[model samples]
Structure formats: structure tokens, C-alpha cells
Target chain A: MDTAFCPTCQVIQPTTGNVDYFRLFSLQFSFSLAVEQLEENYQSLQRQFHPDRFASRSATERRLSLEHVTRINQAYQTIRDPLLRSEYLLERLGYRVADPGQSEPQDPAFLMEVMEQREALEAVDLSAAGAAQQLGRMREETERCLEQDEAQLARLFASCLPAEAGREAVCAPELRQQIVRVNHRLRYHRRFLEALDQAEENISEQGV
Target chain B: MAYNERVLDHYENPRNVGSLDKNDPQVGTGMVGAPACGDVMKLQIRVDDQGVISEAKFKTFGCGSAIASSSLVTEWLKGKSLDEALLIKNQQVAEELALPPVKIHCSVLAEDAIKTAVADYRQKQKSMG
Candidate 1:
């Protein structure tokens, strides 16, 4: 049987066995991950398992170092981003939700809202005296929306993984719907920020 | 690292970068972004009543890879049926643009924008009906 060796303990752990990555790392599935905590974990892992650190080891130890490094990188990438972590959880549950580039259905009213926001951004004239002020208001509104969405995501994560309950309530359909809404709002906020950046660039270029 | 030169060329001179009137019933707008990189892309396609993409345009605020990805998709989506356009994948975009492994997500974002924009349009049509 294929096994993964832990770089820290030098223990050969079976990959096919029951070793939950999230559980091992003591991370909850939520948008509230502290970046500093993640960074600390990554640094610790790098110190222990990075290939350069294992250069003087035997051939098997070197192979294990590479494998651990790959897993550490993959875990870091997933845990660092809220959206990716949510998507990873969904995928782990056997949901075949396509990435944003896939042809999944989206809500129409949400799209309409996106269009309206785009129009509002385009209409703001940076040449005007209050254009920057207006754009700032828009940016504030977008940031508020993002904060609200993140709060909702925290609630969703709690509901899906209630500490009182066991793993039985993990994959509810409502949680899936909530995830989709978070994804949509996240997309909108990103667009608004981009528009804001473009407006600022234009203002600077014109010496406004 | 210097990105693939071809990818850089497309990014710097992104073809079909602009916008269509979203208020137009025939136009569908797909807005997508990566929060991690703070990159945002807006893609719009004008579809005829027959559901064929008559025109495509985009406005992307991102790194060179993202701009190139959306620009390439707009050119690829135009004149194709929505169904055919949905079939476009990140791998194809990455392969055509020769994106490095690290930048492959840029193509993925572009591919998503196309599907999303088309889906947004179809939803509008359904509500109207």
C-alpha cells in the first residue's frame, strides 16, 4: 500500500488510510481563517520538509520530503483563499460544481445588479470635480457588500459543521446555495474594485 | 519570471477589449474576478434571437495573463452558438496562449467568464419568456 511519510516524525503514514488533512491541521472550514496563522503553519512545514532541508538524508527520505512538500504546498494554496477552500470542501463532498469557467447556471437578478453597477462606474466622470468622491462612495458600498458576504459565509460554515453535532450535517443543499451566493457577491465586489482602479488610473494620467 | 512571450503579446494588445450596452436585450454580461489576485474581468456577448453570438467584447483589469485570457476568449466566442462557446476550456486557452503552470488560473478565470456571461444572457431570456 502506498503511504505518505510525515516529515516531522519520520513516520510512514498510509495515504489510503484515514488521515484527514483539515483535522490534522486543526483548521475549520470557514472564511475566517487568520492569515498569520496560516503563514506560521506554512513556515513550520517548510522548515521541516523542504527538499533543501533534507538534502543530507537517504534516498527514501528525499522522496518523502518531496511528497510532503507537495502536499504542504497544495494545502497552503487551498487554505489561504476562502473561495478555493469552500470550493474544495464542495468538491470533496462529491459535488461536481464547475469552476466559474464552467457552464453552471447563475441567478438573473444578480446579473442585472452587476450590469447596473458597471453602468454606474462607467458613468462616473473622473474629469469632474466630485468624480473621485463619487467613486469613493461606490468603493465603500462594494466593500460593505463584501463584508456582509463574508459574515454570511461564516454562518454557513458554522451551520455545516456545528460543534454540537457530529459529521452527519456536513453537506446540506442549503449550504450549497449559500456558497453560490457568496461566490456571486465576491465576483461583483472584484469587478467594482477593478472599475475603481481604472478610474483612478485615468485620473492620474490626466493629471486631475 | 517572464511569461510566455505570445501570452504577453496578447495581453498587452488584447483583442476585442471594450463593452456592449448591457441594457440591450440581445447582450449578456458576464463579470468575473479573482479575489486572491484582485483581478476583475467583464465580458459581454451580443446574441441574436437565434442564440448565436453576434459579437463579443470585454474589459479586464488584471495581470497580463488575465487580460490575454479574456481577450482570447472574446475572439473565440464570437460567431459561435452559446453551446459551442460553453465548450471552451482553460486548458485550450492555456495551450493556445502557452501560459505557464502558475498562470494557468488566468485562463480558468477567462473560461469561466465566457460561460458565466452566456448563462447570464440565457437567464434573462428565460425570465422574459
Candidate 2:
């Protein structure tokens, strides 16, 4: 079923069908996308589904417009954020990202790295000299890690596209494993960034 | 969401909230992470010459439940032998803390941390012997 209007009636359709977010935005199933283009698409979709336009129409049409708008907002929110977008794409391919504290045995070395980073962040004396500079450096480092993981995700996702234009895509086990690996790294990066933000908040709260 | 009294207690005044030397042959270290909540947990155990867990410590960066889970386990680790510590389960942790359904994973992480720490200790012993 089309995400927007019915083919025969040209009327807004109910959101019962499982519409992939990429299809809703008419986008290819890839991680790397133009944010500006996505913004324009989102704005246009919002205009098309604006519930106010259906105020004079049938009751079904009004309800359908509201549903479509809600779905569009959710889809846009998911695709606009890189971490969420990657997770959504993986979900589309039938991969379930492990929930917090439910992860498999991750690499010990990586966990140690994460532990050290968190420990360093925890030990920072916000009122100490050059604290702001230290926080800035940490934020930049975490952001760099996020960018690297995103770039790797883009490459991996591109490799797993369907062979033909309309064929169903099959995700090989190796690809899924790599995707999961990068997803975990992205999650860690996000956590570290949060820690950095908390440290900065601490400094400001101290009136330093 | 409001944490139960037990979870809050552990979170506010976490027990054994520190680190042990990973290089110490008598110390075993386990590091684990939950990608779902972006929580990392590091659990360490120091074994006595008699093979009993003499001391335990943890450093967790996560939600209240996670911090409490690890903190609670460190307390449990003391006075237990390595083999006995391996018997500890996430379910027990969850039940003790009265963790909400969504926060059960925090207990699972603590369980994994214990197993990993024990494994690390065993590995070091084998290499030394």
C-alpha cells in the first residue's frame, strides 16, 4: 500500500500498512543521505498531510490525515538522527539491536577503553583550571568517533543493498555482525558525549 | 521512573565503587557494556591465596539500576569463593533489587561482569601455573 494517498480514490490512506521510513521519504535504503534534501521532503510531506486541509472533507479523510501526519513526524525524527537512522535501517533488515545491559559478551579491550574514558570523565574537577578546554577536547574526540562509525555504517549499508532494483535484500551474517559491532561503538560514543555534557553542566552549575 | 528503595540505596551510596589493579595476578577484571542504554560496567575481584574472593570493586557508567546492580554484586562477591561467585545469576540480582521489567537488563549486565571477571582470573592462574 502506498504511504500517502490511495491510487484509485486519490484520498489519504490509513497508516495500517507497515511502511518503511525510507519509502515514506522516497529515499534509497542507505545511511548516507543529504540532510537538506531530507528536510525539504519532510516539509513537503507535512504540507501534503496537514489535517487542516481535510477539515471540510469526510470524517475518514480527516482521521487519515491526522494519522499520516503523526507517522511522518515519527519517520522524520528517526531518519534525521544518525544513530536512530542506522538502528531503523537495521531493524528494517530484521536485525534487533540489543537493549541496555542485555548485550552479548563485547570485546574486553573495548570495554576497558570505555571504562577508562568514563573514569577519566568522572574524575575531572570542573572547577580546576583548563577544565572547559578539557571538556571541549573530550567532546571533539567523541564526535570524531561518532563520525568514523557513521562513515563505516554508510559503507557497510551500501554493500548490502539488493542486487536488483526491486528484489528483496538479504543481509549476510557477516554484514549483520559488522553492523552490530559499529552500532555498539556508536552507542558508546553517544554515552561518552553525554558524560561530556554532564561535566560541562557541572562546571556551569558551580558558577566557575 | 522512580527507583525502588533498594536500587536507590545502591545508586546513592554504591558499595565497592572503585577499581583494583588489573595487572595483579590475584585480581580478575571483567568489562561489559549494554548498547541499549549505553552503560559500561567494569567489575574486578581479588582472590586470596586460599582461592576465596577476598575483595571486589566496580566502576559503572549507566542508569541508576545499572549502578545499583553492579554495586550490589560487589558486595555479594566478598567472602565467596571463585566457584561460588560463578553461580550468581541475574535473576537473583533482579529479584533482590525489585527492578522494573525494563531495568532487568541491568542485572543481566552485572551477571556477565561477574562471569567475565572470574574468567579473567582463571586465565591468569592458568598462565602463571
| First chain TM-score for all predictions | 0.73, 0.90
**Which regions of candidate 1 are displaced past 4 Å?**
A1-21, A34-40, A96-105, A126-132, A164-169, A198-208, B1-129
> Can you write out model 2's per-residue Cα lDDT over B1-129, one digit (the tens) per residue?
989999999999999988889999999999888877778899999999999999999999999999999999999999999989999999999999999999999999999999999999999999999
Q: Per-candidate TM vs. native?
A: 0.56, 0.95
- Kindly list the per-residue Cα lDDT of model 2 for residues A104-204, writing each as its tens digit: 64877887788888878877788898899988988988899999999999999889876344556668988988888888899889878977888898899
Error of 1 at A205 (Å): 5.0
Deviation in Å, model 1, residue A13 alpha carbon:
6.9
In order of listing, the candidates' clash counts read 2, 2
Model 1 per-residue lDDT tens digits across residues A142-187: 8898788778776776667645422533658867777766765765
Q: List the residue pairs that clash in candidate 2.
A: A100-B36, A100-B37
Candidate 1 TM-score, C-alpha based: 0.56
Q: DockQ winner among the candidates? A: 2
Model 2 accuracy (lDDT, Cα): 0.87
Alpha carbon lDDT at B34, candidate 1: 59
TM-score of chain B of 1: 0.96
